[model samples]
Target: MSEDTTQDSAGFATRARIDTSRPHSARFWNYFIGGKDNYEVDRELGDRIKEIFPGLVDVAVTSRHFLGRAVRHLAGEQGIRQFLDIGTGLPTADNTHEVAQRVAPDARIVYVDNDPIVLTHANALLTSTPEGRTAYLDADLHDPEAVLRAAAGTLDLSRPVGLMILNTLGHVADHQQAQGLVRTLMAGLAPGSHLVICDGTATSEGMIAASEAYNASGAVPYYVRSVEEITGLFDGLELVEPGVVRVPEWRPEEADDAGSGAPVDAYCGVGRKA
Candidate 1:
């Protein structure tokens, strides 16, 4: 719930083709993160899940912090100047471009998302520094080839890119299929490209219950994997230090790591292709 939603939403309702009749994962997540882009149904389910398991709010909040740290590391330390951020949800403070450009002003970024609500808010995510470039693609992650083909217009595929797919793989029900999707995308990028992944894990009973409750709320089901499964997603890539641990523990800043040591039901890792 720590993400700052500073984007203006004037005339968003007229432009967006959203189905408010059902609960959506993106909107639900938006509600959890304290964004105003969600509908009443999303807030209702979010509130229900909050009562079922309040820790989920922390997962939403901390997962975003993990993103900022990861982007900073990639742009500053890894010297990665291009980023391909798939499954980009609603825009918030310190987005991929914002974080990357802060470290490297000329970092080029391409954000891909199929959600209509996200497309409606895409303008907010498109703002970039004069030295850098940012573009949005209304593409599905299921079609990695198409996603890459479209992204190539904005990003140079020959150079190393920071491929980010955070909190999004759970939508793919089958584990192998999800792995293949990642492989297909990574295969298209040049060597030295980093694979950044973070997703909910079946780490505790409460988290599992929360997942079930959310699925039963008529929202798109988001499956949580075990820590071993999460690690498997980064199979061929070289993992960074403290590999595949909880989100907040991955290269955390002093103040962010202070009291956030409690176990969160989400795990993340950054890996590089040789």
Candidate 2:
């Protein structure tokens, strides 16, 4: 819980200022995922949300599983080498680069986040395969062009890249702008680029209650959409098999570990630009 706000030389991180007065999205996510990079405030809010919706911890874990599955599909099966992961929360097990690089050592990844705490953890994220590369951007997702421009230093935009915005779009309350931002980013990538997304939905009373409580918390509000609305985010892209299903339903690992067969409120999909 040290409020360390160091920046890298790329200026991807601005002033060293870690404001712990209120819970932030990245910190809360870290707390939910059981990472040690969060403060008491984050853990308090996370616990409160769990009280409102006990299944939130499950949603967080399964969403991470979806990330590993999606990245595996893109890197191992689809042969995608470059990945643009926006809204990458605190680094944890099976991160985008870790998952992708494990499959294909030459895979390049660029992680973007506007949070400075994430900036402080950039060193942990910047570790990449000598055959590949990884970079972190302290940039905003609302501006796709700038992200791409900054990413161009590491990724070849002319080639197919996997664009991942998992559990991030909900932070953008404006529906039209969210979809538009996605399209803008996709439009910039080459054909066959993949887009991976997963976010919580108002699918259950518990989830709805959880969303309400989280919104009331002083932290940034995350809007959960309906199934149809969530699925529509990939309107023009060609969805992969078993399209827009629950996170666990998407090519889950063949393990006997079944936390609960009951569906979590989170929805996700992986689509190809072509």
**Pick by TM-score: which candidate is best?**
2
Question: What would the per-residue lDDT of candidate 2 be over residues 23-140, giving only the tens digit for each residue?
Answer: 8889898888778988899899999998888888888888988898899999989999999999988899889999999999999999999887887788899889999899999899
User: Per-residue lDDT for 17 in model 2?
Assistant: 69
Q: What digit string (tens of lDDT, one per residue) describes model 1 on residues 26-141? A: 88998988898888999999999889888898889888889999999999999999999999999987899999999999999999998888888899998999999999999999
lDDT of each: 0.91, 0.89
Model 2 C-alpha lDDT versus the unseen true structure: 0.89
Query: How many Å off is the CA of 40 in candidate 1?
Result: 1.5
Q: By lDDT, who's the top model here?
A: 1
Off by over 4 Å in 2: 1-16, 255-258
**TM-scores of the models, in the order given:** 0.93, 0.93
